[model samples]
Target: MKRHPRRSVPATLTALVLLAACALVAVVTIQMLLGETPWIRYDTVAAALHGTRWTDTVTAIVGAAAVLLGLILVLAAIIPGKPVVLPLRGDLDSGASRRSYRSTLRVAASAVDGVSDARVKLKPRTIAATVTTGRTTIDGLADAVRRSVEERLDQIDPAVRPTVRVKIRAVRKAS
Candidate 1:
């Protein structure tokens, strides 16, 4: 089954900060109800809020921070999540990782005659391969690699059929 890639860092940080703030408020409230010394005095808070310069500076900083945080949250909600796996033939959960697809394509391309090495890049809608060939004739090498890679892709039958692009590079002969 295709799973959405996780946005862990922001989510984790937000959760931790919220939990810490809640714990602090809870502790302070409990101390106040018990008539114990609070971590922060009410007078200090009143003074800070009543002061013109400090209050204005704090308000501006908080406003800017809130705006930035809102933008981040909006962006996180709007951006499309990337797929964790590419669906393949068979059971509903059957699929392949992108790395597996690239490896399969690279092996397939490298199997072509005269191909010394192969590098493959798999995208959502395209499969690109670069092959290094030996002294063999350059004619039809790219086509052969493309055909081989396409055949492999067809066998896998991924959710999206990617167009194949082959690039051939010849190895330099030793002097």
Candidate 2:
């Protein structure tokens, strides 16, 4: 019953940056071959490759740096760690909150006989939710969801009392 941890933003961003760098390098290489602007002077560079020139050395260093930077990015994404979880601020937590009570609540709701989607929102004094069940009545499915949620919460806090409201957002048409 292990829930998948969310992806890390930094890691994801690093991965995207790496991909962009690789793409940029590929595009630049293609442009160099095609005699495009900015990359229009490969012949001179190739000639420089034959000589012991400072420009050739600088170009080699820059290329190496770019490759090393890209490698570092790919490594960052592959490192093992839990996804970053930013805590809700005190102000936000005290207000009408919608934190998932537990994974079971979502799993249970999703498992309901006719529910296509079940999203539960917990507020100060009530639990407002929406369920998408093609063949299920909204009221009946909502009540079921509420009961399931309450039952799950009761295990932790027996005195937990919250009004439950269920709304049907959409029903998929059968083909």
Candidate 2, residues 1-175, lDDT tens digits: the string is: 1122544676677779889988877887888678777543667767867775555768789889989977876666565443223133243422112334534456666676777887776554676667778872355766777677667656534233567676766575545
The true-versus-predicted C-alpha distance at residue 41 of model 1, in Å, is 2.8
> Which residue runs does candidate 2 get wrong by more than 4 Å?
1-103, 136-139, 158-160, 170-175
At residue 104, candidate 2 shows an lDDT of 47
TM-score per candidate, chains pooled: 0.78, 0.37
Worst 10 residues of 1 by lDDT: 48-57
lDDT per model, in order? 0.84, 0.61
Clashes of each: 0, 0
Residue-level lDDT tens digits of model 1 in 1-175: 7766777877888899999999988998899999999998778888977775644877889889999998997788668576767788666668887677789889999999999999998767888899998854688989999999889988999876889999988886535
Task: For candidate 1, list the clashing residue pairs, or say none.
Answer: none
